[model samples]
Target: MKYLVMVQGSQADYEAMRGNGSAQSPAWTEDEVKAMYAYMSAINDDLAETGELVDGQGLGEPAGTRHVTLGEDGKAVVTDGPYGETKELLAGYWVLDCASLERVTEIAERVIRCPQPAGAPVYPVVIRQIMEGAGDDVC
Candidate 1:
């Protein structure tokens, strides 16, 4: 089955991250950035070898993104960054085809075990099954 794994974060958490910035930024130490990326790259390599990984990518900070929705008149309504005040915002996602939910859970667990920047907590990874398409007649 195919699944979409969503990674979310909270506003307070993001604010703290923003303060940490990239290694190029004045806020983060070079060692800290290097360790973070090293861990991330290792995880990517593991996923590639597993064959369960379909596609995955990390996103830029949410402050640079926007949210758009349709209003009652069907016109587009745009909103500023991060979309909502919810405790979690999507940080990144991965789509994978796995043999069973057990397999998917294992993958998620591995992600949590991967190293992260010092002081950064493990973010939740939500797994959701994709809906299969019906024939044209169903529509």
Candidate 2:
């Protein structure tokens, strides 16, 4: 089975990415970013060697985000910027081909511990199993 491990970052992280000041938490410093990159690199290397890593990449800041929705009259309504109260945003993701949910959960554990700021809290990772194709075998 394939599992997607999504890294959901907090508002503090969002502020750091956009060069804005975080109201409550401190932004991720340069050293923290380097440490995080190094940790992620090591993990990626390991997963690639094991043939478990399909693909992954960190996302850019939410400053460039856009939202499009249909209005009551069915017209498209477009809005820009990182709108309301998004405490957590999808920061990155890793797609892994694993044998079991338990194994994927284990991978998530290691990913959660990826080096960040000294006093920063651990962010949540949303793991989802990729279902088989529609035309595939039923049995």
Candidate 3:
């Protein structure tokens, strides 16, 4: 089965990572950021070697995000930036082909352990099984 393992954050979190600390998140030192990248890279390498990694990537900040919705005229209405009221946004994700939910959960545990600055916000790592079918109604 394939699983989507995600980590979420807010704009404040992104700012903190860039050394602009706010009450919502602490500033991350240059070394601390490098450590996080190294750690995540090691995990991805291991998964790739084991054939469990289907795909993975860290997303850009929310500032450049675009929101689109259908208008009354059936045309697309576009808005710039993250969701109007959403405080948290997806920061990164990994698509893994694992043996079971338990296995994916184990991987998520490692993800949650990624290095961060002291007092940095801790958000829950989400794991969801990917649904695959052709109108099979596997909701």
Sequence-dependent TM-score of model 3: 0.92
Stretches of model 2 off by over 4 angstroms after superposition? 17-21, 134-139
lDDT of each: 0.70, 0.79, 0.92
Task: Arrange candidates by TM-score, descending.
Answer: 3, 2, 1
Worst lDDT run of 10 residues, candidate 1, spans 20-29
Candidate 1's error at 116, in angstroms? 3.0
User: How well is each residue in 27-118 modelled by candidate 2, as lDDT tens digits?
Assistant: 77667778888999998998899899999998876666678999999999998767567766788999999988998898899998887655
What alpha-carbon RMSD in Å does predicted model 1 have with respect to the real structure? 4.5
Candidate 1 residue 78 Cα shift, in angstroms, is: 0.8
**Candidate 1 vs. true structure, TM-score:** 0.74
Clashes of each: 2, 0, 0
Poorest 10 consecutive residues by lDDT, candidate 3: 130-139
Better of 1 and 3 by lDDT: 3
Query: Considering only N, C-alpha and C atoms within 3 Å, which residue pairs clash in candidate 1?
Result: 9-89, 10-87
